[model samples]
Target: MAAQASGDLSLVGISKEFETFTAVHPLDLEVPAGSFFALLGPSGCGKTTTLRMVAGLEEPTTGKILIGDQDITDTKAFRRNVNTVFQSYALFPHMTVLENVAFGLKRRGDKDAVAKAKESLELVQLGAVAKKKPAQLSGGMQQRVALARAIVNRPDVLLLDEPLGALDLKLRRQMQIELKRIQSEVGLTFIHVTHDQEEAMTMADSIAVMNAGRIEQQGDPASLYEHPKSVFVANFLGQSNLLRASIEGPGAEGTVMVSSHGQRLEADASHIPEGAREIWLGVRPEKLRLGEGGGPNRLHGVVADASFTGVATQYLVRLPWDQEITVVQQNDGSARALEGENVTVSWASHHGFVLDAAEPADAGLGHEDG
Candidate 1:
């Protein structure tokens, strides 16, 4: 096993290419040391390729990989102090939990292998399962075992490749918390790769949203969700009701006035693309309220569909322009609208965002649901 080294992961112009096409484009990124960072994108978006390059499994076609100030571009996979926990877990069925976790440490002839493995298992809350075989454990437990195996090595960076993907939703959410806790306790930098938006936002301290083998945006989860600079980032990170609008210049309190579907709407001026007159007025489903709720921005629409999802009611409002927008209202026993009723959707000026209309509004739609 490799020894520990505390260092930020820097990918300077890092890229990957295959015989047919480039898997990853020239990329520059810095994953802060001891932060939970996520490479979030759809399948085949080159996130996995980028992760493999950092683990020294895939040689980069260009640029260098560094841990802190040390250049590890030429290092071998086994020599780099980076460990990967994959979705498959891959624990040996024949070995006990402790044996599985201790295998790597023992292979390196570490004298405290058992003790280290025990501590790692306990860190993952699996200390009691040390004597149990892999087959006796649940899927989530198996995932934890795999994590313990990697953590025992004390790698400077822990790479999780959809490690919780195999479990059910409830279990997966549970593991997200566990993973974050383990990372906090261990204080090791974690680079997680997954396509699930919620998974990345829930566990990551910072997120890099990737598309077409390139970084579209990178920031804290709330910043990316609230102030998305690109249409793809706005739509892909969360559900957005983007309506084509023509900017009517500035508004009061630094907001932008825009006209859409014969109605005037206001958006955050700071979110408006610089010098972009034509824009898409964007609002989240949760940001909209049914009926005229005293917000500056309002749209008259027919309730095309409504679905009750326990605590919230999701309404699909069909605007006069024949476009459908979603509105999620809390079930607080208020007078909710029916499917066929005509209503006005209203939201605060600050709740709306603006994106460049030059790009397709539907961009990142298919990838998000898949």
Candidate 2:
């Protein structure tokens, strides 16, 4: 883990409440200097609230906010060296792009506000539209203007609350690359909040998955997806097929035998509890291999449905236990499985992960359907 001491921003035991409702529970997070970190969750998970607190738009009910080792828990929004780009872009309707970008500097009475704004506009490749009003620009262009406005001040931290939410999918993806390039050039800490898992995974150096006003797990995108700590994180971060299993006995090489729906399998016990009686085995859809001739962890299933997604083909397999498992295969221009065909689903023991027994009863598995 990267040390928090090296970060430009740190939140320690932060919490926020509104009257009878707790908007955010105690949360601790660190944003490494010059790193792009994402706070990802579903709606009402308090990601936006956390960002607001960091931007000084909301006061925390408890805990300290630090910027480069200095406590700024009580600092006013303007006094703290942080800027935010809101979801709506929030540009002044009457102001031209140039004036909007220069607004913050003008408030600070900076003599070079206009020059700085022009330079920032150039940075976002929007210099040609500097004199145009917000209404005159396309949604993507308006978003760029908003970004230029935020970065013109060169704040220590830039908080982006779903700045791409309003854009169409294709434009959003294009902006994702642009945002990453800008972050690299500025070398400033970026704390972006969004409920879009794909966006977070595409842009963030690390991500914190939040749920129900609390952070369920935090890690690099790969780790979080491959080894989710709880059921919520597993399901929310990406699609996962979880199997309920009970430990049968010890096996070779620190592996354990488990039984699921009358099928016996072996899996690595390195991360599971020593005396784990029950466990949820989680495997990504793409990890499962089709056909027979699997090494150790293999099962037979009938293909229920298959869909071609251009780049990949997704298979819905039905197991003997009446559970449906999803499997995805890259489209390599080769013959693939057909619907209603019997195939064996297999994955290496090391390719999957097992949650500890101490986790919630529903951990590592979503709601089971009848």
Candidate 3:
């Protein structure tokens, strides 16, 4: 048995429901102390609802919310040892950075409110801007001020609700790195909620991919991406080319052989669920190699489209089954396939994953391609 987590955030059978809508199903999750955890999914996936329950903003219809061993299900929002930083920044325009950071400490009647706030500001590298009002700071600076304000309280768990959504693409990336650095320095448990796959994978120590009020999968970013158990996870977390196939018994070295459009493909047997006859073969776009090159699995297709994307080139290949698959190859200035050209795609067996076809495959896939 796994050791019981201490000083960590744990949700036990927590769930939420409206009059007729079940926003969140029963969920049991644990965020390890001092680790960066993320609740990742698209809009209305109940990720935010789950966060709200933990924050004590929304009471769960059933079960308990615990910080370590203390049950906080009925605790008031203000009484819980948690803080949330939202995307809006929500800094007071009239208050200087120091005052904003000191607000929580002042309310709690801390004698060293100003000193503690200043230290928090320095923690976020914003002590130089202590005298500036929120209006005088840039968007990113304002964000930092908001962060300083939250962390100044030294909460057990810090909740971030799309905290970088307001920033531009470049600034968002910068904040992702900055947030990870700050989380490490403080050794605080951070539960970040975001819809962006890159943001979750880049910053979180573990990620829970929520969909339709349930957690489809939860694990370290690399494990979830490399060995997704569900089709939704395979496509939602990253780009995947899913091919319909049927199991044809075992192949060399304990690998499973599956047939797709009269072509045999080999995949790691462990990825094929027991007793699953028909499955969707999954391979990441970057995993595929163009022009065969004697790889284990091969598929011939016509290049429907091709585009150079600086570091890599993307090709849309239409297979014989009329499914369009994406292939990405590094731009080494090598020979490239043109539109309407016939090309062979291949990849090593281990790179492939198999998912049960009976499971729903339409859970928020193809957003990038669309």
Candidate 4:
């Protein structure tokens, strides 16, 4: 299969409502042509519903769907240039891999269906299994067949709705890389909807974090992880430690000063959200260094727990206010903190972001990583 280009995808004011509840609210989004975009959120956050609306599988309550300059809102699911791959591969169990991949082309009476299917299988690196039935393949190979089938159709947009959900941990991680590689090689517009934070981060050029039928934030992986805009995004996208604080005023060199339990601290002004009646200092576990008096922003705490996970050591540090904060340190021969040891946690002010204290502190806890 030669590399093919796709039109940019657009969703304008799209919403889906049932009798009692709205699965998705009015939403406006644009995906650049051939970009790997992810709709990421926990269950019931509307990511899947929004993907379904685009696939024309579910009628939208309002708004239009477009590709480039063309409107496709009312087009039939089969008529529109879109293909979907679900968690279930749904490959014909009794048919050969090539036959299954060529099913759609053959149904449409395309003369070169068999030839095209061969190329598609090769693109997914499964040409050798073209003659084998799906039952004769492993789970990962079965998944590649599903991908080859979808790519053979050459749709303007490919919608993946938790397609890797059934794979085990190691396989899922490996497939994440393969999926990204395939998308890049084909240069097709790929819209992936998944609940796994790491999967989205690993494969997507951009990600929209959804919460309660609304897009909380959308940006590149690093921006979302380093500078989340809300409590939900900060908590949901990854683990974070939020400290109760009050804005004291400005600090030296364009920094925002805050007071936590009468202790002064500094953070980059951009990290602090505006009009914050109440405040919480946001920091990532990896950004914190276990030590005393090392950074412009420092806190005194006692080591509550330490866990070594090969690559790094994670610690639970308890502050004087009785709040426990998480810290992660690279296991690079640095002194490790032991349990019940008094210590200070430090980080550069620029590494921290602030969020309004009004939102639920534990907003995104207990989400399934599938």
Please list the C-alpha lDDT of all candidates, in the order they appear.
0.91, 0.86, 0.90, 0.91
Per-residue error at 230 for model 2, in Å?
A: 0.8
Which sections of candidate 2 miss by over 4 Å?
1-7, 273-275, 293-295, 356-370
Q: Which stretches of candidate 3 lie over 4 Å from their true place?
A: 1-6, 366-370
Model 1 residue pairs with clashes: none
Q: Write the per-residue lDDT of candidate 4 for residues 1-370, one digit (tens) a residue.
A: 4455557899999999989999999999999988899999999999999999899999999999999989999999989999999989999988999999999999999999999999999999999989999999989999989999999998889999999999999999999999999999888889999999999999999999998899999999999999888888998888999988899888988797899898899978876676884788889999998875457888898999999999999999999999999998999997888999999899999889889989878878867752
Candidate 3 residues 100-189, lDDT tens each?
Answer: 999989988999999999988888899999998899999999999999898888888899999999899999999999999989887888
User: What's the residue-level lDDT of 38 in candidate 4?
Assistant: 99
Relative to the true structure, candidate 1 reaches a TM of 0.97
Top-TM-score structure, candidate number: 4
Give the Å error, residue 108, model 2: 2.1
- Against the true structure, what is each candidate's TM-score? 0.97, 0.92, 0.96, 0.98
Q: Which stretches of candidate 4 lie over 4 Å from their true place?
A: none
**Weakest ten-residue segment in model 1 by summed lDDT:** 1-10
The TM-score measured for candidate 3 stands at 0.96
